[model samples]
Target chain A: MEDRVKRIEKALDHFLPERKGSLSETVTDAMRYSLLNGGKRVRAVLTLAFCELCGGDEDMAMPFACAVEMVHAYSLIHDDLPCMDNDDMRRGKPSNHKFYGENYALLAGDGLLTKAFETALSSEAFRNVGMERAAYAAAVLARCAGEHGMVGGQCIDLATENRTVSLDELCEKDTGKTANLIMAACMMGCIAAGANETQINAAKEYALHIGLAFQIRDDILDVTGDAKELGKNIGVDAQNARCTYVSILGVEKAQALVDEHTEKALHALDAFDADSTFLHEFAEKLATRSK
Target chain B: MEDRVKRIEKALDHFLPERKGSLSETVTDAMRYSLLNGGKRVRAVLTLAFCELCGGDEDMAMPFACAVEMVHAYSLIHDDLPCMDNDDMRRGKPSNHKFYGENYALLAGDGLLTKAFETALSSEAFRNVGMERAAYAAAVLARCAGEHGMVGGQCIDLATENRTVSLDELCEKDTGKTANLIMAACMMGCIAAGANETQINAAKEYALHIGLAFQIRDDILDVTGDAKELGKNIGVDAQNARCTYVSILGVEKAQALVDEHTEKALHALDAFDADSTFLHEFAEKLATRSK
Candidate 1:
């Protein structure tokens, strides 16, 4: 797992736009700063692992892995903006807006998002694999990142702030905000590997279950984890009166929910013919993570 | 020309995301409000016109044309943010941030940008034309809109605020902020039509010239045009101490620069075997427009 994570980190560094000593260098600098910040490369690792499980070369999946990470990083930058969550720090470091000011941070987010597509579409691997598959992967990535997916989820989150939301409503928001990208990552990997429709569907199922589990774990941590370990302020959801799994169900119930989802996620991997021991471990670890 | 503009408008309206009765509906609503707002569809028109010039069916290029317009609209929304230009009005209407609030406006911009790629990549026309061409067009569009292109230009623009810059420096900034998208529009049109390398280069040259002319004309309008005529505030460049062609060389010289670039643009159109009367007229009209 550490080896795979290190590989993703290296690929992400390679995929970032190079500084050309131009006036726009600062925005690129900010983009790199936020993207290369030390964070668990969960989505990227899933992409690579799923691709490998589907009998695709890891190199062929590297670009897609990096692309998802770029989208993730860009979302974080925007989420921390003064107009959004206004977070001062992320992952034990200053938030993008705090380090680069609101203006450059905004541009950096925009840059990273745009670069994500560029990286995926321009990759030689796409040509080698198949243009149709590349287009499909790109379409999925864009759709998951756009209005009906991550952005939509964020809109709901902002609107529901300072108010309690029903469990179903929170689930809907989490599916859009969290599960969509994870689903996209898994689907893109299957597509890249030329996996059959059943295999793709199985990957989607796994991703959905794990995505929910991951979010529930986050909620549990927000209530019970230490800020130092989490690399961010804990109890933020409580302070903001934000609707979350723990807020709605208590930490005990949330933990039970995480276990339920993790079990389902592991079961979904049974559809795969290849060894999924790594994924099983990943899901179990996510369910019981301390931070 | 009016017919072409109408076609582009319809295509943009068609391509916009539909609002389901979901919590994210507000962001989609804001995206529609800003995108469908009455404005001259210059970039879209250029895309369709160039496609036709290359002997391609107009319908085949509609998606790409609308995609460029979407990028243009998203840029304006972000540009008007409080952390950026902070303009309260756009095209005689309240800016997106003013109408939707800064947070929604930001998400709307994000949604639009992501949707742009989705529109281009998922179009049936791309499948018909060839996925390779579609991938190439997507790559160009993404690059022209990303950090080294429009975002980079905006970064330079922000960094140079309240200061005078040299004419060369100003041109570099405008090229990224303005010309890059125009170039992408023209190149995309050529790619959609499967034009040869020479034809693509010709379209690029034409776009570069007109792009510079358009920016110069903008500077002239800011100095001499009426706020009501322009549908926004005039003298903004001067007020912000922006380094523009007019600020550096006076209106007369700026007007001359517009004429020079327009002439060169018209000359570049000679490379096309097809009738370029519409594009020729378009260039001349842009050079002398009051708004």
Candidate 2:
């Protein structure tokens, strides 16, 4: 995992736009600052792992994996804006806006988002994936990141802030906000691997279950996880009056839900005859993680 | 031209997402607010006209045209953000941030940017354009809108704010800040029309010339344009302490430059034997128009 994370970091470094010592220097510097800042690189790992498991080479999926990471980085940057999450720190470091001011942070996010597509389309990784399938993957990634995906979910989350919401509503947000991108990562892997419709659907289902579990555990960790391990301030959701799984279901219940999701996610792997060791362990570790 | 503008507007109406009645309503509403606002759909019209002149069907290029417009609109929204341009009005209406607040405006710009790629990818308008060319066009769009293109230009513009800049510096800014996207539209039109390399290059040169002319005219208007005629504030460039062609070259020299670019633009269209009368007329009108 560390090796793969290092590879992703390296690839992102290679693909991300360089600081051109002009106006681009400001935004690109901020983008590189936030993007290269330490994180687990879970989404990129999933993309590469699923692709490899489905008989695709990591080299073929590396750009897609990095693309997803770029999208993820952009979302985190925007989410931490003073107008959004208003977070001052992330991964134990000052957030983009905190370090670079809101203007640079904002353009940094924009630059990263646009750069993700550039990476996906023109990267050497897609050279093996073929243009048609690459286009398919690009469409999928954009849809997942667009108004109907992360942006849509973000709007709903913002609108529902400070309001008592039903579990279904929160779950809907989870599906749109968290699960969609994860599902896109899994689906992109399958697409790159030339997996058929059945395999793609299976991967999508697995991603949904695991994505929800991941979000629930995130809510739980915000309340119970150590700051050193979590690398962020605890109880932020509660402080913001945000709706979350741990707020709706107590820590114990949320943990149970995470377990249920883990079981379902593992079960969705039945369609695959590969070793599945990494994914099985990944699901379990993510579900019950302290961070 | 009015007929084409109406067609472009209709295409945008079809392609711009409808409210999904969820959290999507908030951001989508904001996107719709800024996108559908009245303006001369010049970029979209140019896309359609160039495509048609290259012997492509209008309906086939409609989505691509609308996609460019969406990209243009998103740039405006972000450029108007208080953290960016700090504008209160656009097209005679309150800016996106003023109407929807900064957060929504931010997300709305984001949503529209992502949607531009999505529209380029999945719109039925690409049915006949082939996935390869469509993917190629998508890559072109993303590249033109990225650090080397719109965002990079914007960063440089922002960095130079309240700073004295030379005519060469100002022109370089204009090329990146404005010419790249226009160049993209013309090149995309050629790609859609299946034009060869020579024709594509010619189209690009034409776009670059006209784009410079168009930008110089915009600078002239910023000084001399009436608030009602321009449908926005006047003398904003001088007020912001920013350098512009009008400021660097003076109004008379700027107008001459516009005329110079206009002549070169028309001459570049010599590569096309097709009826380019509309384009020639369009260039002259755009260069000399009051608003």
Query: Whose DockQ is greatest here?
Result: 1
What value does the lDDT take at residue B183 in candidate 2?
Answer: 84
Candidate 2 chain A least-lDDT 10 residues: A17-26
Instruction: Give the DockQ of candidate 1.
Output: 0.85
Q: DockQ, per-model, please?
A: 0.85, 0.81
- Model 1 agreement with the true structure over B127-197: per-residue lDDT tens digits: 65777788878888998999889998999998788677889889889989999999999989999999998
Span of 10 residues, lowest total lDDT, candidate 1 chain B:
B122-131
By summed lDDT, the worst window of 10 consecutive residues in model 1 chain A runs over A122-131
Residues B15-113, model 2: lDDT tens digits: 775877665689999999999997788878877888888899887677778788888899999889877889999998999999999889989999989
**Residue pairs with backbone atoms closer than 3 Å in model 2 (clashes):** A23-B155, A23-B156
Q: Against the true structure, what is every candidate's RMSD?
A: 1.4, 1.5
